[model samples]
Target: MPGPPILTSPPKASPGDRVAVLSPSFAAPGFAPAVHEQAMARLADLTGLTPVEYPTTRRLGASARDRAADLNSAFADPEMRAVLATIGGEDQITVVPHLDPTLILSDPKPFLGYSDNTNLLCWLWTHGVAGFYGGSTQVHLGPGPHVDEVHARSLRAALLTGERLEVTDPDESEDVGRDWLDPRALHEFGDREATEPWEWAGPPKSVTGRTWGGCIDVLQWILTAGRFPADPSVLSGGILLLETSEELIPATEFGWIVRSLGERGLLEAVDAVVVARPPASSLEVRPTKQACAAHRQEQRDVAIETIGRYNPDAVVVVGVPFGHTRPQWILPYGGSMTVDGVSRRIWADYA
Candidate 1:
């Protein structure tokens, strides 16, 4: 595939800039006020910017049309420099169809989100605009003591500046979640362990292409919706970045998603792949750390096997760190990504 050109948009955010935060999918904040408040406060404290909220940002069970309207308003608001989502929800794909394509394309601004927000990121790219994943105030911004250093740095670059984004190896990584009930748990319920160097396992050489993909579960929705997300011609040689959400989809299901991508001819069309650490278990499953890690590794192994079978020529990098992680970095969707398998890092260049 041809290299993706840098997309066009205004410069990054400055201090005191206005940005809109909305819940386009599920309103996660409704159930957890502490996380929601902390995330909002952090945005102001760290960025020196005011976050404007819309009607449904904290309202769960919001209609898809209502969420879509909030998005359009945020994009159309002359004063707002950018738009952000609180966090990703399972049903963002439902909002995609209701959105005004013309309005978004004509008045595009910087957007921040990941996970289910992948629907929006992919949509923006489909409409010829760039989107940023890895900047959810709730996830990156926390009710805990502070934001993760790696995540904060990345959020800064992605929101206010465009620089050489470096991928960092976590000295310690945690696959655990914070407890919403016990304040003590909120202080520190998660576990962290030593992290190995990122593994890059794609082709024999380096290749750069546009970046795409999101939480494997959400991507599945887009694929099943049966709408045209991109021009097939431009997809040739694009780089695919993918990760599973904290919901901890089964290993067989993860493999099935990759196999489906191959079925849809998406795997062969991309030059390389960047996979993130999957979310092992949510409160729903409440699996132990050992079980969570084991499940996640199994899913990763399944994805690796599928990619090998379907797109053997494609370059693949395992564990580059994004999606559902505390210190998530915003990745450029449908932008340039250089996969250096030897170096085990995927360098994403955004417009």
Candidate 2:
């Protein structure tokens, strides 16, 4: 029931530093070695950092305890400057309780991931170590024909230097991505969709605070498991960043989830809420262009209505390109960010 501690940004990694790329969730690397190899190549090409893999990094059926052990090893290794997830999976929540917080706290290093990896980020935040909330090796680096510039810039800022950088929407985005199992997936980046300008709502003022929240469904799981800080006040004055995953939950379900947060006093505690563009089309369920548009609009309306009911004064922005969508931006899980409703700009201090 204690609130989350004051967060401290971890030391940045420099070029030539050794970074650990592990599978703390599902071992997607084991199933798709070609994709994993490409991702490692891209990581090296983009940042000039050496990637070291752990025992569970490619062990498909590794247990939660084994994954946690890899995390412990990564944190305790002096040569390892940072830890990155090979890719996200469905049950990283199972790995959380097994983590050795003392090891992580003793040598805090930047951890990068999204989706199911939200569990780990929330765990680190509670222990006061800030993490970068995007940059999955498979999704961001492997499947695509080339690395995205937006992602590349944000990754560099998060890992190399501390600087105030503006978060901008990518010129293009894709809800559907390539299939890692297919060889052609390496050459196909999926179709690019025409992007709409970000929609802003609420007061015409700016709010600066530490960023929190992640994939909505994963956050719900975290809350349900009692893994999040029990004290809601810890989120007071902070900025809430929410996004949906490929599951593309219905608008009503999304509203219900937001309502649950409101009932828990989370919605009212934040200064602003930023919603990422939902991925309406998935590999299993590819909707038509018209259907995708309608789905996105309904989600936007539901989010605004739900937030308005809980905290009318909170600033809100939708479609910020930081989710399952392509050309994603890396957000600091517990680092400083400025949300300016007046200027319609968002800046993050990646320190």
Candidate 3:
């Protein structure tokens, strides 16, 4: 994959940089503290660095302002090189309204997370601060019993190192969820599924643009709250990313959302779209793999039509694994992305 060309901020990490990990979202540690401990240990092992925590990281029911404050302190601290969100939570939209953009924009660094973390990623872009969209100590750091190589490599590149990351489908994947309370399961890798190759649906072309967009569900929230991005021209040269969450929103509904964004003048704003594999929601969706597969494709088709309806020129690539799923890869929001549709390749460059 070719590295993307956009540069919105200076790289902020070296091999031994001190990175702060905070929970700008919910802290499940109260409900699953062991999982949190395991995740932190795993992150330290993978990065060859120490992990610092905030008072609210594992504190449930923390106010939005409190989370926002922790976020500000993490960014403003001179000793920090990068900031990592533990895991995503619902209602991060709340964090946005109270966010102090000045804290982050002035001293930008690598920021990583997915799911609800979308709120912050979009916020960073709007305020002229670049951030990354993949990698989390809790998810990628704790994939199954062992961290999948794909997630680890991508996380490392996004955080400590800014290099052209290798994008490859995992040979096998697991969708089973274990009780975070099960201490024994913590030592084991989760179940596995054979993975098909990442596919691009149309004729080849390549575009270099800044990375934007996040979990589609969260994008919906931002849109509904009038927090959706301002204009397409601002995103005119950037690669726009869209991924589904575990909620498994239907394809038809997905189309409606994109069409809505188009109505808001969003579709024509991008040069390309990187759509993710729709998350399989129920046991039913998982049992019927073929059906689940079809659901994902249909959703992509709907997205393509929705965007094409508004801007026929927008390029769409399906299946960049990074959101609400296993073997997640890191994405750069407000950073550069290179989509080579001709070669059916995509790469987000942070350095």
Candidate 2 lDDT (Cα, 0 to 1): 0.90
Q: What value does the lDDT take at residue 59 in candidate 3?
A: 83
Which lDDT tens digits does candidate 3 get at residues 244-287?
Answer: 77678889888888787788766777778888766765433454
lDDT of 1 by residue, 1-351 (tens): 433444554457788999998899878778787877778888888878889999999898999999998998888887787888888877787788788877766667789898888888877876678777778776667646677787777777777776656677667666555765557443563656665455555567788877778878888888777654444445677888889887777889888888988887788878788888776656566777678768867866887789888788888877767887755667877657788766665675645
What TM-score does candidate 2 reach?
Answer: 0.98
Worst 10 residues of 2 by lDDT: 1-10
Best by lDDT: 2
TM-score of each: 0.92, 0.98, 0.91
- The runs of at least 3 residues in candidate 3 whose Cα sits more than 4 Å from the true structure, single-residue gaps closed, are 1-7, 282-287
- Error in Å for residue 266 of model 2: 0.5
Task: State how far residue 168 of model 3 sits from its true place (Å).
Answer: 2.1
Estimate candidate 3's alpha-carbon lDDT, on a 0 to 1 scale: 0.75
In model 2, the number of clashes is: 0
The residue-by-residue lDDT of candidate 2 on 149-170, one tens digit each, is: 9899998888888778999988
